[model samples]
Target chain A: MSDLTAPGFPGEAVRLRARTGAAAAFPPAAEYGQVLFGAQCGTPGDQLDAMRLVPPVFMPQRLAKLIDLGREPLYQDVELGTVIGGFSSPLPVYVSALGSTRAAGGDLGLALSRQAGALGIPMVIGENVVPVNGYGRLDEDAGRSLLGRLRAYTEHLGDGPDGGVAVQQSTEDADAEVWNLVYSDPAARPLLDSGRLAFELKVGQGAKPGLGGMTVVDAEAAARMAGQYGLDPVFGEGRVLRSSSPGTFTAEILRQQIRLMRNNFPKARVWVKLIPGRDVAEAVRVAVEAGADAVTVDGAEGGTGWAPSAFTGQVGLPLAECLRRIGEKPPCLLVSGRIWEGGRAVKSLALGATAVGLGRAALLAVAEDQQDGLIRFVECLSMEMRLIVSALGKYAPGEISPDDVWSP
Target chain B: MIEDGPTQPGDPRAHLSSPATRSTLRIQNQLLAAAREYLTSAGFTEMLPPVIGPVTDPGGRGSKQVDIDFYGHRYKLMTSAILYKQASLLAFDKIFCIAPNVRLEPLETANTSRHLAEFHQLDVEVAGASREQIIQLVEDLVVHMVQRTIAALPEEFAALGRDVDAFADLVQGMFARTTHAEAVADLHAVGHDQSADAEIDWAGEALLSSKSSRPFFVTDYPKGSRGFYDRESRTEAGVLRNFDLIAPEGFGELCSGSERTNDYAEIITRMRETGENPQKYRWYLELVKEGIPASAGFGIGVERLTRYVAGLDAVWQANAFPKLPGVVSP
Candidate 1:
């Protein structure tokens, strides 16, 4: 540890830590987790933004399309439908893991779920929701609970075989047996029967690469969760900081965990979410080899409920670097960071991402208009994807290749 | 009905004269005769089932329905006669149908060793029967069918390499009864990962069936696992009064039956809950509203039973002309 008062040292973070004490380690996400993220604090070296989708002058796929259609082709001729991590999705995008943070847990969470369900895209409910909000309580307000989000998602889910839901479990959530509860809950029967449910193993998130989930809990809830979590009185009387341990895992542990998931929830799809670690490519290979249906890579630019701002900006590999590191055609490679627009999404797809995850952008969209904000946001992104793909002389999202993206 | 027309290339009739198929047909005929004998002796009236209807059972577990244009309206090929079995109870206390069904099961199921695109079912219904009554009825019917087939064609069993002792436990009343939750627990204990709230998945079902020496009834399936016609328990909020009769030695589910719901309000609510449009089920709902009797019934797949009894490798071996999920055959 270097001296904090060195004349040439970067002094802003240290000075802030001095003023706020232990509280400075985590971002002020309770006040601005859903809204202000990605606008100001983002990975400064995002290579996805550096790449451009360059269209060809000779459009043979479009010519083939013309012959197939017996006329000229348009951007609308592009089809976005794809299978994401074993779930049929109308678009090559999904609602990423939004957990039981204060800003995302209640009505807004339900609203986001409904929109995502109606859109016929898979939605991942993030970690620690069960431990924090109670699995579900009918006697009390259950709207913020994990079951509440599932019910909300299934309510507007369409008749087509498009959408599904994946429930994530952290170490604390594993203690609650979140997967077993959802696997047996009557509320999840529709998805289970239809083969649309999945269980996501939370290895780590992008925002905090090596740490567990962090949330600001009220004193009463803090006292209740004190046994399961590391509860620190960093925020004084009314508010406390709750920290969960990032569960230990080796390659073999990951392999067996996926095997256990497959054996325990045979009806449900198996998903493994990996952080933007230095060895992300190896982790992805290990997960895919162990029979994971989908392996999600959350880049350093990914958002979280609570994490240190330093980690958010500088802790892990950017999504583009992760994709480059993983190389070509890893099955069901789901990458997420600051994926808000079609340009970055198309670049990700070209760089070998099977699909892009909408995280903070989804939260912001839902917060903007709880009714149809996500729907509109997706509409714009999808339209842009179609236009870009069609211009590249391709008619499907999966047809995008590295040849189409120009790094310069 | 044998056809006299010119045989097309790759016709299934080419193999009809084979020894294996001949033995299979012999066992099938005996099973059919035994089913008719057993049901009629129990005071069940035999009725020809309608092959096309405005609405059919919507709980085929990921299977698609076949549709045809009937006059100006769209009609669906029967997946199961479960709905009409309830209506048939209006004229008779007990009824049975040698019914034909068509289901477009997922292409992946073609390798499951138990699925067929076209098949027949021995559909049976009894008025004023409880879930337990139906379970007992299915058990007895299965025992009788197996015993009759063995007695009628002992040499066929030997020729097909089917051991008569394989079904001894069934004939000796060794059929076990387990709840859906228990079955799921059993699968989980073996690392099968079966969902407790849904039907046992295909692999899990096979695992349980293989472990049993005798046929067993898995009862009290959760509400959403089956169609709305399966009655919900008044005592339990989400448990349905239903059961599936699984065959031994990994033959998988042989029969599925449940106590039928005749209350119009409950039927409508359940229909909506299961994602079925009530308007499409208008005729059935109207009949249900007119006070149909409380009944319990089940449909046992004839091909599946024949396959199990003959110890065949696949259900298609039991049929003269097989139609696998994605395969086109005569």
Candidate 2:
């Protein structure tokens, strides 16, 4: 094994170890057991590369833009600004949902929030944080509670923050009243006032489509909740397997849930996160018809948390196919999977996606520089997006048509 | 064998041997007799409850069903007699059972007085009945049971510190009916978060129960939060024809009933929608295909009912061989 693959870095040995007891030539190593977190983690991006975007040599969109901007060959005034889930954003990009995994929650969560705030793009705080961590004034400087992520997201944001924070609730988080607490908190008053707050009903995620949320907890916590949740003590000693219900959903059920969200929390925007299920297109249509402001599709590639090995590649439809199935007429479609660079983001935007979510890419970008990592990473992506969109002769993300793409 | 105060925690036999346990058991016997007398007079046949089945209710509330090796095949311990209740309709139009159930409830729920790993339910079903009719029957049955206990065991009530007059309103058949939407709105108004799509969660149920002074019905839950057996409302889209009779003053839910979805194709579709393997329900599906009666039924938590009537602090006090969730007991 090479030195880079030895332990701390991403290399061939790591990939082999990830595939585990298989062979030298194998799939890339992911969360099956590696602890080294960065952008280069988890399973492959669910083959999003199946769809390609064609950059035309002609420039009609540029001429139309010239009419709009009242100028010439200058695609400089391209409007990247757009609305996502009822909130204004400078670009059609948002941070994908982040669960309370050890690698992502707490400080890293705050970092993601601060950077997302800086970029003025929306962020989704995933489930189990409140039940695992206390809902308090986290610290003098950093509050790590549900409100803490909100505060961090808003703190670094300059005047007139464009994007918002969407609090996503799983069955467990629902039990703990994650959204209720956030919606009523004085801390979120500013966000609500700015019309930049949303509550995402977690129907499914890309990692484990039909499965519930799973985590490894110690014996004490397990014993405390032994009567309320299922705990498989497979790890022995202190460790045990704890799981939450996956939540059941049918077509009528999806429609009714959205209506309920609208009725109960009338002040906030409603969003629904969907996994790439077998009926991805239908689910998207159901969500849209039910009046969802945004329907996020977590592609099979973007689960950054710990999940069982069986689900990573074997389960759920890929992101590209999900987008393709949702087809040309998009409904505030937000897509995510191994999307850090602008090329992939642009490709997603062209293939009937209203926006792209940054999952591992956002986390790793922060891990890359801590202070300027995410900003620099986003800047690089923005640069690529401008260059690519300009090449397509379209400035705004909405201008990217299905005619600009090929699907397989 | 009636002994002293504040019984031991783990072994229930010690508690059962106590005077408090004796009184509780006496009241419990009256409750059973009262239930049987009412059901039998109301033209219902009582049967011995089944211990295992080919498949059980997919209690999606995180509770698990125990599976045993039935020779080479797998059989599950009955979580509730719901499926069998529907099947039993073939033999008698109205059937009832004092059935035992086992649920591997989540560990954390051990604290809630509402949950238990092992318990009994007064399961009732009636063919060609509407959800409204069953809910009325539940109210009548509960009133009859409470009145029977009050008349037969006045001393038990006095000893347990419950006023018999507290049940007067029930005897008069006066109860409030709250829809799922109204209940959710109430919860939100009181600063609680309840999913409008799902059932009123445990805390929300307790809050609503605590606020009420008398037994009330929370009805018409949205589809998908319950088992596939609960029939969806044909007239009202996305709503189920079901109701949960919540015990007043924070005792939580005492009984849940719904109009059964009897159509075979619909049942299959529902099973798939609920993510259950359709092949596992071979026996029940075959019965459905052969046309089980259209029924509406409910399982009243016997211990919970007794706890509410006796004014006991916890449900375990109502059962001799009480099994608290996650607790090892006799």
Candidate 3:
């Protein structure tokens, strides 16, 4: 009868009594890493011997959905609409995390965020943005700061507030209390109020597991950073090794970190990014138990701003393998590494992923045509996704299951 | 080992050479000499450590290894001489060395009082020895050093305000032995969070160390938390048959040792599981493939031991030429 829904309304039970008269109706509301989870799509998708999607002739779930539809169902009836890490999305894809790439800095970052928001899917703003670019409230240097991305996302966000922006915090960022700063800032109030902000605690990346971030800097920069990082004049006398400390997370530390996030900022969602280490499944369990809204695992194929060449090729587990290792799904499992298309996306979803992240693919799409490039790319993906679901004799993205594909 | 002294720019001479650091330095020297005397008496031969090698230990806490140009080939500075310790087993069943190590530890470690950019370890390897035997050797060696120091120089302890009585209980008797599970539980009981499946973190380790009244062994660290050589336990699936010796009164980890794996197949599996490229360990892996002796050993941080013994403020004080991580010093 009234606006009151939840029981024991904190501010006033008197107003609830006035509306209900002890028998009134109450309306309720509900809310819901591949390579950075792209597998190595090396061969040009034209393998005559490549594996194909295999759907059973007796589609029990599809038949059930068809019965629910009160008629024979087609591919178009598939409810592609799903909630990803608390954000509503038109499709099951979200822009994967990206750091301060040249394209991720000023105008390009803004454009990408705007487009991601318009697409109604969530986006993760990756590490080092706060440390390299500034936090939004201060000088931020011509809108290349962390808050700049949020502003871009919020400005272009359409009427329904379907997308959220998750900002990742590395060890350096955590040392700077990036989450605390952003959570408490008035500038971020809009995103907070709209429930469109999340914080991703970065444990490790796929490109380099068990190692910190490594980058080369010129002699001048090295001299300045020599006191802050472990520097070496490895590339001759002119260049130095500038390394970042990886965030330490044993199972307990991870649990406590996620708990701390929930306690400190009740309004924002908590996410964790893990390198597909040998114990990916264990780490995922710990994260989910600690009340994380989502957990992202990046396979060894994930890219980074600065990583050793050896690490990229040799270090983490492949995304597909990581997913297979995890086996069963937690409540929300997001993957990335090299994920860019429909078949792989469908395979990942069928393999128990809640959603898939678009990393380098999103960037390249935007880079090729900043205005409509991403739009066209995502549209084609949506179409392919529909086709795959219909071919599987299922109508929803989430319905694509382990039964839909055959693996060796 | 260098004892803590005043640090000023352009001061070439060690502050340890000064009169104020004399007593601490004496204790430091005694600790080393006592270790040498004990190990040699125990029939351990000493080896000179290599400064550079093809690869170094993949320091798990994200400590970076220093790579140098070794005649146009990429060579890493010795982060730990554990690999060399294993190789030396080919020559001597019992080997010891006051080996130097360089670890580009994270900047945060600079504040922890236990870390040093350049330091030494009293490395001892015993071929054909069990984990218990090596742990017993450590106990005996540590006791002998302390008793020798306490008897030889009581005034040094007084001058440095270190209580000679700290070694009274440790003079004779095996130290406390706690499993990694027990230590984690103790930490949790103290209102601290510790990982059940990873290495006891730096903070957790310090917390446990500070709470102890005597030096203790925390054994059975998780398999993935360490370098590949630490042999996995047959009885325990997830744990390595390794141990870390934690100093009393919050000085933190003094040393780490483990039962080394000898099987080629097992080592390769461990290597891949740890994300280590087996190729990087060409020489060491060759030794494993060809068959090296099954042994157990530990390396005690020379400076860390000196700090705990002399009651110095930080590990840098134990160095004659210190490299306080991130600080440029000669």
Candidate 4:
């Protein structure tokens, strides 16, 4: 091993193991592979900004929503609606997973899927978007493929029932099976007959947790991913990199890959995600005891496009210590990292998550306005999550729990 | 009900001299002469199909698939000659066609009064049949095309006033069935949560066809909600021996058969488990690997059965050059 040395580490790992000789065991952007990683200017130590939502001096669900709305209930009566991974989201925020890199793939991922489907929430769409954009072809022009961000998120997700999309996939989208082509797409049958679809799975993404997914391209897209991914030319002869792999699960192969994605995409909605590892709460208790329907996680201050700026400020664990090691009844739980405003999404919904995602702050609010900057940055994070859930006297966002947070 | 007809780029034959398009084309020619007198008196064999293909029917519901450029090889067009009614059941094992499909659909199903984007189907099949014999031959072909279009057009269903007692419980005997987990638990007992693994949502099939008054079906479904040519129900491990039918007072679905996947290694593992690309079904899996029979088909639509027997409130007023979906016309 290049003269192994373990004399009490750090000296910036011994002057980066003497300027990365033998690429000092990966990272340091494996010796600069045609760079791209963005957003990184100090902002790491997390634990949901050392918590604190704490309100209760007497609130009994705002006195049962002020005697069931016979009066006093403002903060727009809270209810930033929810249901994420099973869709119906009008709020508890979503948008996360933005893959195929080059700063949030194609048309800024269809203008963040047409303003997160006209602000109804839920988005995802990450991983190598159908092996780099092309699971489209319904006689062409479904640009930015993955059925053009599922037809710009179900044609501006109008006919209510909140929003939804999900997608994800990875491991080179299971050799382009990308959830069996978005579960047998007919442009994903109106989001699988209106359950608004979902699929997710991925396994590890916060910046670069346990690696896989690297992007960089251009050697004519790494010679069209010559023999499917893991390209490398050490990002040189006209920039290449590519890569993918990080797949290899265990908890019974992640419970038989969520029972073969519920016996092969039984009308989608499965989810999963995970990464801020250190057994991110036993992989969210084995993907919600193998049935998933939303799990996410991310954390290591998530945000990527091409990592190794020391796995974007030191790899994994942070979205408030993966929601304090996924505690407090995490069933749907989501969470992300560097979440944009609404005080870290109502302090990751007062610490038991169930929502908060908006990754790289929804690609920097649709790169600052691609038709209403992520709808006025989610209408200023849904009016700062209804004035922080009606100033913690709560009215909805599932009545903000963990005794409305407060850590040391 | 059959009113629409004015495209004025110089009124191309103003809806063929309307009188409500001549009583909706005389009740769609006795609903295509009672579907060719009930599939040639039940023996079948009609055929005409192939309106350009190399592959069509990639299982719709969201539609899109017009393509053409044929001489240069990109074909397509017929969005439902359901694989040429399963390769014309190997030249004959009971067939039927009336095909002509186009499909670009979704423009939010152009105001959903039953979409069109150019249509027509009636498409049957048979060979060795059985998904309970094509759901009893599509409920005796929709009660022999509504008793032969009400005895050869009762004055075009009384000049389209239509209401032959809405086919009293569908010409009596057998029409109501359900199972797609009891129409998704009767659309989650009226709250309409539908999706018992999908295929029911045009507003939950118009809320289970406006709580049915006749004509039903629904059946199995679930194996990833269709099109690896349906099949997959060897004693139900995810169901799907197919079905749909619908059409009651709400006038929705009107047929969508199944029980197909004719073996060639389960049609190449149901075309790679429904993501298709079995090399774009090379000549229909080389004629289902040199064989093609195990049928049990269905198609229906024909302007949604002439807009539910000419009671026409939409399906483009039961056609005559309808098209609709994203509009634009000739």
- The CAPRI quality class of candidate 2 comes to incorrect
Error of 1 at A94 (Å): 0.3
TM-score of 2: 0.58
Model 2 Cα lDDT, one tens digit per residue, A1-408: 111111212333322322232222223445446665454435333355555568777888887877877777443555678788998888888888887666676677788789899989889988777766645643533355677788888888878758898988876665444665665456777887778889898888888888877778889878766644568988887898887778778886677667656644556898999988889889888889877899999887667776788888688878877877888666698998777666678888888888898877677666554565567666656656776788788878888887787665
Whichever of 2 and 4 has more lDDT, that candidate is 2
Using lDDT as the measure, the top candidate is 1
Error of 1 at A136 (Å): 1.9
Writing each residue's lDDT as its tens digit, candidate 4 over A1-408 gives: 122222211223323322323233234665477776665566534667666677778888888889999999988888788887788887888888887776666777888898889887888888887777666765644667778878887888777788888888766565455665565446777777778888888878887899888877789878766756778777576987877778666565565456456645556688988889888888788778767888988788766466778787777777877777777767788888777667677888777887888766566556555666667666656776787789788878877877788887
lDDT of 2 by residue, B1-330 (tens): 122323324465677676666777888899889999999999999988899987787664546566677985558888898888998988999999999998766554566766778889999999999988999999889888888888999887777667777777777777789999999999999999877776688889989988877899999988756767889888897788999999877889999899999999888766655445455578889989989999999999988887788777777777877776656777
DockQ for each candidate?
0.02, 0.03, 0.02, 0.04
Q: What fraction of the native alpha-carbon contacts across the interface, defined at 8 angstroms, is recovered by model 2?
A: 0.00
Stronger candidate by DockQ (1 vs 4): 4
lDDT of 1: 0.82
For candidate 4, the per-residue lDDT at B226 reads 69
Candidate 4's C-alpha runs over 4 A off are: A1-126, A129-198, A201-214, A218-236, A240-267, A270-300, A303-331, A338-350, A354-408, B1-245, B248-252, B255-330
Candidate number with the higher lDDT (1 or 3): 1
